[model samples]
Target: MNENKKPTLEICLTPDAVSFIDLTGKIAVIVDIFRATSCMVAGLASGVTHVVPVASVEDALSYKSEGYVTAGERNGEKVEGFDIGNSPFEHMEQEFKKIVMTTTNGTQAIEAVKNTAEQVVIAAFLNLKAVTSYLKSQNKDVVIVCAGWKSRFNAEDSLFAGALALKLKGDFWWEGDEILFSTHSYSSVKNNLSKILKHSSHYKRLKEHGVENDMDFCLEIDKFKNVPILKGNILENLAK
Candidate 1:
């Protein structure tokens, strides 16, 4: 809480490690770059009122009767009977007031730190600058939680975490093993994100499912000026 001392930056490379991270008094930024967090950013930017991220398809379905649009994916495909998949493009197409979404990794990451973090914000390449700027303004210690693929380490999420760390370097002091790895990973791919990520596991999975366009969209830096911040289980546009 000392203004003169720099806030610290840490990284949780996967949701599996979220349990061990102490999020108390820190601003947790959840990154699921392959799609989920990207879609949440796109959805809010496209005029959706709020997004409720649940841990499973069943949890998302529970909001169906409440007039919430159900969206999510299991194994890189849209869940049967759900309204949409975890594609940012799909999110931008609809103008629903409320959405209940779940995914293999992103939502689980959010749920992991929802109770412990002082504040939770969703981040992706789409709104990178906005997110970093907001975090810098808050002056709180930050924990960047990467929603890795299926509870395992993934390239895209770590890269985003690294990018955030690099951006916050002047305002925060980096800590943790993942932060070091992320910083190097981000620096290596600073010039060519799409090219490097094409070889990633989730990227190939999404490509096989024929949603390469979504991958392209998610990698664009600062595509939206909005930052989605979680409040009481719902993600709302911080820009508003």
Candidate 2:
């Protein structure tokens, strides 16, 4: 890190791009605004103890015998045998001590950078303020990794990366074209996020699965202050 320059921040628009960047020693804020990270923040704030994010349905199901309930979705629908889908409202409704979850894109995104970054923090509009504050406190180079739909770019995650970039511009050196683009785009639609994103790809996918409300809850900015930090294999938040 060049001390003379401001702490650097950039956005990795998809999981496929994760390898091209060096994540070591930097704080990676994982954003999956269409749902996964939003569910995590809501779960912690709603009294769930921990979330174990896995990349496969088999891995998430394996935890059921240990008293960990399974929650997940594939291609926008809940996996047939899981206890719950990846919905922020479900996290708010159910009571659980811990959960193992897998999702179409979010967990895959986590798998990409979990080991490489010095720290990994979950971010969603639900915990936007908390995430920004967490980065500011660490004062390290930052990368907002967006979990785009599958292995391709999606607008919601990119919009979120922009929303986060807007919050951290003062403390970090903007380092990529993605950052510049998201920042400007988010500024124009921040007040109308739901309207701008409605009927979009992820939204329509989730809507077909009857989880329209989940998308609404996921877009609520600053709704929770809990910062779900990945510690070892699970993410836990002690925030009150």
Candidate 3:
């Protein structure tokens, strides 16, 4: 480990594993590729003012009481009594002033590291280039935390993490158990991202619920130039 070299990159394949990692000075990029972080990135990129990611439906509802637009999902379906579901396409269809959202994995991952990490940002394929660029500029050790399905590992998030790992390899030394797997995953599906996503567990679940369009929207690479940064408890457009 060269002390003068750029900071190393690591990957935590699931939120449940986050506690074991020391995130004190690292930049944590939360990846929930199936939809949560994707929707957050889309919401901000499509002009949503701020995104408040909550750990549960109760929290989202609480914010809704304060006039926030509530959106979330449970098991890949929209939660009852909410304004919308976890769909980037739905978010892109209209502008929202503020969005309060919760999901099975994504939001939970965000909450897990909010206090420990030096900075937290939401990443998806839509903002891949932007996120990598920001990370490069900061030159900080990065941990790509995948909000796996129900605290378990999932391919989509790991693939995105691997893509980031590959993109940053030139500037950062890759570290962690899943780094090689992630990079391999990225290389295997780089040209056929959507096709590979369609075969993912969460993607199939979303399809059963008739939200394949949302899945399609989420798999698009670099669809937006914006990155969503978590400031305190809110996610604001990094470009702002």
Best by lDDT: 1
**In model 3, where do residues sit more than 4 Å from their true spots?**
1-4
Q: Candidate 2 — number of clashing residue pairs? A: 0
- Give candidate 3's TM-score: 0.96
- Compute the lDDT of residue 36 as modeled in candidate 2: 91
With a 3 Å backbone cut-off (N, CA, C), the pairs that clash in candidate 3 are none
What candidate 2 gets wrong by more than 4 Å, as runs, is 238-240
Clashing pairs in 1: none
> How do the residues 9-114 of candidate 3 rate in per-residue lDDT, one tens digit apiece?
8899998888888898999999998889999888887778898998888888998668899998999889999999988877765657799999989999999999
- Span of 10 residues, lowest total lDDT, candidate 2: 88-97
Model 2: per-residue Cα lDDT over 1-240, one tens digit each:
656567899899998887889998998889898889999889988978899999999999899999987988998888999998988877776568798999999999899999999988999998888888888888799888999988899889999999888888788888879988898888888898899898588898788878788888888889988899999999999454
**Candidate 2 residue pairs that clash:** none
Clashes of each: 0, 0, 0
Using TM-score as the measure, name the better of candidate 2 and candidate 3.
2
C-alpha RMSD (angstroms) for model 1: 1.4
Q: Considering summed lDDT, which 10 consecutive residues are worst modelled in model 1?
A: 1-10
